[model samples]
Target: MLLPKQMTRVLIVGSRNALKDTIEVLYQLEAAHLIDFSAEEEGFSLGAPLPESSVASQRLLKLRSLEKDMGIDDEDVSGQMETGQIEMDLASTIDGLEAEITGAIESKNKINLRINELEADKAVLQSFQALPLDLELYHDYDSLKVFTGKVRGDPSALVKAAAPQSEVFLSGNGDFAAVFVNTAQADEAQKALVQVGYTEVPAPAGPGSPQKHVAKIDEELEALRSSMKEAVDKLDELKDKHSTFVKAADEHLSIIVEKAETPLRIGTTEYTFAMDAWVPTSEMPKVEKAIAEKLGNRAHLESLEVMSRMEPHGHDEEGEEHAPAKVEEIPVKLENGKTAKKFEFMSGMLSTPKYREIDPTSAMMITLPIFFGLMVGDIGYGIPFMLLGLIGLKKCVSDEWKTISTLLFFGGIWATVFGVFLFGEAYGIHFAEQAHDLSWSSLLGVQLPHELVLGGFEIPLGIYSKLHSVKQILYMSVWIGIAHLFIGFCIGFYNKSIRYGMKHAIIEKISWLMILVGGALLLLFVVDFMILGKDVALTDIRMLVAAVLLVIGIGMAYKGEGSGAILELPGLMGNIISYTRLAAIGMSKAGLALAFNTIAFEVMWGHDFHVLGSNSGDIVMLIAALGIFLVGHLTIFILAIISAGLHSLRLHYVEFFMKFYEGGGVEFKPLKVIRKYTIEKNGVSE
Candidate 1:
């Protein structure tokens, strides 16, 4: 069905004791999409989580913390364990894992802290190593004030002049200087040091030379680094040993927790509980039977209403958009097969189709690639595209790559077909001979036929050339746009008819269809008069038909949509013209290909372009030609993916889809547990 899957509202009510069995049954069925309960009804309150929730949640928190410490991740998990095994070993495993992880992580943190301190100490010691001073000598001077620092130049002479009684010790390199000045002249000594660009360095209270202190720190740093590695290795060992069990236990507990928490979405009275859900309409009988067989007399299943696509009219008397706020929207699950499923992302990216409307994914799938192939109608790039798409489909797992790969694979098929039959060229050169033209036949010094002769029948190898057939291709593209938009209006009419009524549908959509048809006819008359130099009078039959249709369509649109309809006439004309880009982009790509081919073969390799004169070729010319050819086509190939592919998608998004698609619908999400590492052999898949 092109429509979304049908849904039915269901009410499941039972005594409090049956809640657990009912939840288990629902999980096993995997058919219910539960709606969270609101405490609106009197005497009905939101239910609490089951008794087991607290224990499971606490364990889950601890496991997650351990997971972070051990760097355990989804990718690291390699194997699975049975639920029974996880249940048996979970308690002991968590206890032991906690101790090992806590010890290793604590040790690793301490080593890391010590390493940082040692590194800081080493940086300080490096500065003082230049000066030949013991650490204790620079500090604790009572009779004399000492200034020890680095200076831009030798400050010994400056210090001697500033304080006559001062003794200065300059390093051999002369960049480091230490001055001892008497108390009375300390202020004068400091001023002299500042004039020489001296920056102060404070001395530490250690009892040895800076070199010995740095060596001692280095030994400690090396020891800490070794310990850090050992700590990391211990954590890694723990991760490897417990990886499978932890993953399995997490999955197992998650399933338990999810089941326990189901009650939180149910409304409960003093003695009874009620749960609301949406079940697939087709599965109602099976669900009913399952509930009867499993819960028996303890619980009862009540079928509410079976949902339909015929929603009520738009706005009510109050002019509010949505009049029925209390009505629950039936979730939309698009019933697409495997091929159409691939295009769902492209369509869904815009909006999920409403249950009442048609799913547009199938439509997008048909045209998106066709538009792409039409733009990249060349054999040279098409074959490689197919190969790339195939490789990507096999190798890539993401939704994005799969969609792109689908486009390339299907678009390549049409590209190959069009390149062979329509363009009859590869890399912008013709396969056969033409007057005053370079072709494969001319370049290789062999004869090539213009058409295939099979059973005395002739089939042309080429139809309309992209570069030479501008008028024809442009005219064709405009009509393609018209046909595409015509389909859009038809879909709009159907959607409006279903949603509003036939009268509103006719007024809104069919009027636009009439205008579009009139414009198409008027275009034919205008093209003949202006471009073909033919006599096309206002009284001509085509002109009369166009005028009559346009007037009636305009009147209808004005009555239905007011002055906006009058304004949209020129907009419609522009919309039709927008499709000319399809032909324009193709011509641009062909121009690029021709330019590259000329530069590589005619200029670089000195091969005859046939329109020009012939020339001789050599080994060096052949290599250069190959290089230019490879480089030039590679650029074109990448541009084709971006240009041809994107323009096609844009044409659909901006021009085609806007005509009919109004998306925004709730997607169907069913209630089910997904197990990653644990398998339940006893469970059955719905």
Candidate 2:
């Protein structure tokens, strides 16, 4: 739809609390549509009403606010925006829902508090059970005796040793060696026993040393554990009772704390608590309807006012109605009211040809095929290209590249057709066989006219005569170039006609046509023939005259413009010559193919034949030949593709675009809820 090309005002509502949320929702919606939005607060006012400045900006601001207010980490928010569905009015909805969440959080907080208390009590109980033991076992002996594996005899040990045989007594601190044992074996053992002694000396308080305190410590520890466990059990019960409160508190604080700090407000409008956002222009209506349905009377929606390069008051006249400007719409035509459905069909195929305004999609569609055919001009290469392109189309999910894939598919088809033509297959020409068999008669339905030999080798005239000549292919290349250049001129003329008027179109068309025709003829007839010692045919002389006429026409057209036009003739001439590269590349492709085949077969195969015996050498020759053929041809094919694709793109972008395209048009962005992998049914995340 056409609308005035002017800046539109946007109004947002709600306090800072809502502002963050509102801004977030709108930002995501706009981004999904590829719209660039920047925030501007200088002219914004909360009291006075104004139009929404930019839906994209509003959405983005809201997204930022949502991230900050909700305590959502910045990284998390960015990841969400990247992976989540972008939605219109999602910011406001998130804000409102978050507002309600505060209440729920309050209740939850109470429950969490109770649970914390219970955990603390349980920790206390566990601490009591880990008390250290009170009793200590003590013994004293000489260091030398212990190290030497000799036990010092003490009174307690003597009593234990004699208890099994007879009643015996020992003093607590008395040396064992000073006491004599009343035993029959004592006399015999005494002669061999060394004086080693130890003593268990009783304290002044006797056997009551530290025992009462140890018993008391054990009793205290047991009591502490019982008390702590009882307390933990009571705390757990209390937590269960208040669990809901804790959950509510947590939710409440998350939403309300942030909202209280930053108030949200509508921008210079009475439409408080709600705002509009920009989305992809294509999805504008759907988003608007969704917002209306979700918010009912609370939401206000408006159509997008897209910006344009054309000035509204170009020629001011009294009471003149302004031209309605809208976002640049794709140029499409429909048949049978079916809308042509190019959206799906040309998804990947619709490439942004380097310079779109000059050549446009139409020119690219034509030129790309020529380049592809030239590069992949063999049936074998063409088959791979076609298969690869088809596979890409089938497997690729990005809609952005679908159009490009489609173009390649068609390009492959053209390559195959051209390949067949170049090989003379339709005419039954088999140069490959004739190369081996000099006796072969007819080739491509033509009889041998003369003996065709090259480099002192006798070659079959039937196939070699026709195949060796590149003159026909070269001529075709020149003709194709002429047609292509003419087409470019027509496109330029059409563009000028649409923007300016019929007069300008005619003048420009005539001027360009004359320039192209004259330049091409000069190259093909005068320069090519005269400088190369190639005789000009009678028809070529006629063409030279036409070329002169074209030059004169160009001069006449630019006569009134300025002397600068004359000065620019050299540059124009250069551009015309640039078209010649197309033909050059085509010829190069054919030449390279021939050279690769020739050298690979001759050198590699010839060496094998000279060195090895016939039977064994034949196998080696076949393998080497096949290897060289495949590798050499493959390398040539890759180079050709790169050269053709890049050079063709350059021609379109630089040569063609220089004539017309002005590409700084702002893309249309609408506000909408976008989801990845799946569509959102409720228009909101649960």
Candidate 3:
């Protein structure tokens, strides 16, 4: 399974008419997964010069073609229902319906036509409503003919009058008028006007009247209103019918398009069809079974065969011979219930070292939990993390996210283990009560105390003894740093040995291992010699030899071409020492919690306010103490998590990865309809 990894290149082919369909399907597939693929423009030749166009346009064209093939019409029920049915169809017959429906819906002219018709009818109705009524047509002579009633004033005097003859005309604005026969009749008109609340006008003597044309125009306007209403109703009915037919047509069109375009092929190999795609690698029997059940074997068949390698070429005598490009191939191996290649992530990154190189989904899985656990490193926090990760793993729709969830599941376990260690309860050893008592002996032989000498007298002080000992905390910080560095070395060795061969692995990968071990021994031996005033005993020869071996190994495995310089060695040593920050921050979080609790109880309670002394002050003091404890601890907890998480990532990225990781491996993305934040049964699309 050891071979040089090669970049993947895909070739897609179809009819000229199907090009747009192919682009659309490819786009959908790309959106659905995290896999990276790009089409090669040099593979095809343009017959004529044309402006570049949007893929959406091509998709639209393909959809139109499919609709035409299916005989879809907006006003035709048969076609509209056919398209709608095809869209809703769960069977294999409806495969590629989305593209078809999208195209058909876009290409439809009926909806636009209906909209225009409605707009025209509305305009006509509005125009009729806005027409101004004729005024000043009610002269004395014209009024006398229209009304058979007496005027409200004397025959010689002008007075307002009302027209009571027609429902189509209004009496206001002098559009119509009433006529009186004599002065005696005028008084009677006045009585009638008072009852109706109107003032009459005097009649004029004239045969020619302008109100005649006004009446005629009113009659025509009434007819126009009736016609406009009928037209509006018909337009609404047409729109409803058009919408129904368009929907039906879209369904039928989807089916026709799917049948027209065959599954993509590379030479003699046919790509497995699923959700507008031809998937590669069908080793999973379940996938094949699914394909068979959905699409009959005759239409969608699966065949297994190894792809052929490109041939090499020889050059002519005149110049150097041209050689066929050799395609580097990676041998896949099965591990952890999945197929994987060594250095896959690294190789992929190198191949496409751009924005697309990084997989955010995978990064989330690997980084988030590591960050969370480092922040809340307690059994209590781990439980919640484990549960959350499990839920994400089970329900995540993106395959990439599912992979991340899996990482969180494992990280939670490690965090839980580390928390147990911090609790001082390893192997049933409990230090709950004695945690603050520095006089307590070491658990598992790890020193817990520091010493102080005053006035020529020696005094022993423990790191965990005081409620808040900055010096003690610093000592614990150093120890944590030491442990973190050691862990990094181990990870480095493991990663390199697996990824690269032992030849390269030993010199580059094992450098950290030697540095950590050798440095620890040297520090411990020097400390022992200085503190106890003892010479290096013969009995400790083995440790001395081990230290010597580590130093020699580090020198041999040195990676840089720089000459061995004393200055460089110190820098390298410092880098190794930097790993201790992981443990330092973790311990700092715990230490801060203890310090806050102590301050809250001592400072807050020590204050005696006689004015507020009825034990009420004590209760308030207690509440304040608890508040300070929570707030202080919570702040420290957050800082510690940030420190641990960042340092851990730094150790992995810079220190550990420096030894071996060359992450650039392309991720495997399959063609499928994936729901975001939800689950689906049998891989159905929404």
Candidate 4:
């Protein structure tokens, strides 16, 4: 599908008493994209949220807080809980959980704080353990100053010299010392201690042997740790028991709050309410029937005009105060099929397509992988890539990974095809024997053919080599760029034609098409005259046609878009030249592969082993060569994903999409609930 699904404007008006029922019906249908009501409208004001919103929101908040306190993750949820069961137990369970979880968490925090305190005390006491002293003897001397800490060398002599009455005790290792001096001589003793690189370690407040105090602290620490383990286990048990109910109740309450808040987006009076929305044109009949059959005379649905691509100019000829269509606000619902839908994420990475324009996901689905495959053309790498991609697709649940896997799978398919037919190589080596380089045929002493004859039809296996056919590859890349851009211009032309009109489309888009065509023709002419050395006259038919097309196209483009058109001429040339990366990247990979193959094969066969079956290589050296080959190609394979993948995406995003896409439309999002943990039946979830 090229364009977004058609959306029709709709107005649903209902009695105030039926507002909740109407909201329920619309959500069940899941067909409406509601428009926010403006309070500036005459006699219509924004409605307040319904009665259920406040209570449900409060419960949801508390549940989330409990989940956070328990460190609950989605993986902790083991099974689903019925909505009816959750409703029955929600109030009591929340209260119980709040108390139990709070007590456990608080106990854990207290134990951790105490453990830290004990550890700090033990660290200080260990320093004193090396000294032969009781803890109380170092402090509480009225006329003496005590200095206890570590020192680089013995400070006993210096302290005794500075203060004659001072007593200095050094540990057996001479790393710890305590100095006691008369208060008058404390300054002198401190200076002597500083000279020996002293750093203070204040004795912790206590009594008794330092060893005894340390032993007591360690014992206390063990008890606290055991208590901590119990607290953690209790919290874990609570999490295991209630994780399912917490998650399901969260979902159930969230749905209620969302539905209850619907009135805030609508307009209401004391007796009635009105809501504006957009519905797909195909679903209008179903929606109208549902509202009539369910809500009866209490509610009514009105079908407004179907939105069109044409921009609003002025009132129509017979207009009688009709409102102009809000084209910008018409949400775009892309119409891609299942196969093309995988690329919707890639297109959405840019922006949603406007309702007026084509959805480019389908187009990108075709070309992006082709470009990637062309850049990474190697069967050896392609097969592994396909396998990795397939595994990722099967296992990955995220959109980002799924999209990447899709690219790798599809791109690998094309890479295999190109490697087999276009390049006829695997890991940069030809299947057939090469005149100058090594090949599988040369290495294995077997002859491989360049073509396969099937049912009397000749199918060439090997065509152009990446390293040897630079000119031809480059030429082909340029033409590929031209054709890709040609498709872009065609899409652009159609987009403009629908959005504005045919004349505007011609001036805006078809003019660029002409310029592109003229440039392509000129490229052919230049190739013939200069590279092929063909003598061409100044008034040759190709040259004349090219000149006429360029002039007329430029004139029209300038008239439509002014001086910008002239500025973009050189840019268009740059865009075309950019595609040459398709060839350049492949050649770079080929060159790297060649270097690696040469080194590896050289290690195995020696320097002069160029001819096929000329030498018998050593098994050890051959094994080593295989190791190098494996590591080298693995590196190239990783680089290929980055370089080739990014370049291909860039070519589309920058060059191809720039030709046509103007993507800033809002995505269509209907009011719907996505249930994962619970199932709904019998008017209640199970």
Per-model TM-score on C-alpha atoms: 0.93, 0.49, 0.45, 0.93
> What are the per-residue Cα lDDT tens digits for candidate 4 across 1-686?
68999999999998999999999999999999999998877888899899989999999999999988987788988777676777778889888888998899999999999999999989889889988899999889899999999999999888889888899988888888989899999999999999999999997777899999999999999999999999999999999988888888888889889999999999999999999999999899999999999999999999987998775553222212147564337899999898689889999999999888999999999999999999999998888888988998899999999999989999999999999889989999998888887788887778888887899997877699999999999999999999999999999999887877787788878889999999999999999899889998878888999999999999988878778889999999999999999999999999999988888878877886686445668799989989989999999999999999899999999999999998999999998888876655433533
Whose lDDT is greatest here? 4
lDDT of 1 by residue, 1-686 (tens): 67788899999999999998999999989889898898897899999899998898899889988887887888888877777777777788898889989998999998999899889878878777877788888777788999888888877788789899898888778777788899899998999999889998766668999999999998988888888999999888888888877878888888889899989999998789999999989889999999999999999999988886666647332212465658777788899989889888888878899877888888888888888888888888888888888988888899998989988988888788888788888888878886655688887778877788889998777677889888998999999899989988888888767776687778878889999999999989999999999976789888898899899999888887878888978888888899888898888988888888888877543654563335656678768878888889899889999998888888888888777777888888777889879987543332
- Candidate 3: regions farther than 4 A off: 1-84, 87-421, 424-502, 510-516, 530-534, 537-547, 558-572, 602-604, 607-623, 670-686
lDDT (tens digit, per residue) of candidate 3 on 451-560: 44679875533223222433443445445455545554454444444433354345654655566666666666765677557787745764686578677766655442
Off-target runs (Cα >4 Å) in candidate 4 are 150-153, 194-206, 313-328, 681-686
lDDT of 4 at 121: 89
What C-alpha lDDT, on a 0 to 100 scale, does residue 506 get in candidate 1?
A: 86
In model 1, the clashing pairs are none
Better of 2 and 3 by TM-score: 2
Predictions in order: lDDT: 0.84, 0.46, 0.42, 0.89
Ranked candidates, highest lDDT first = 4, 1, 2, 3
What is the lDDT for 418 in model 1?
Answer: 81
User: Candidate 4, which ten residues in sequence have the lowest lDDT sum?
Assistant: 313-322
For candidate 4, give the lDDT: 0.89
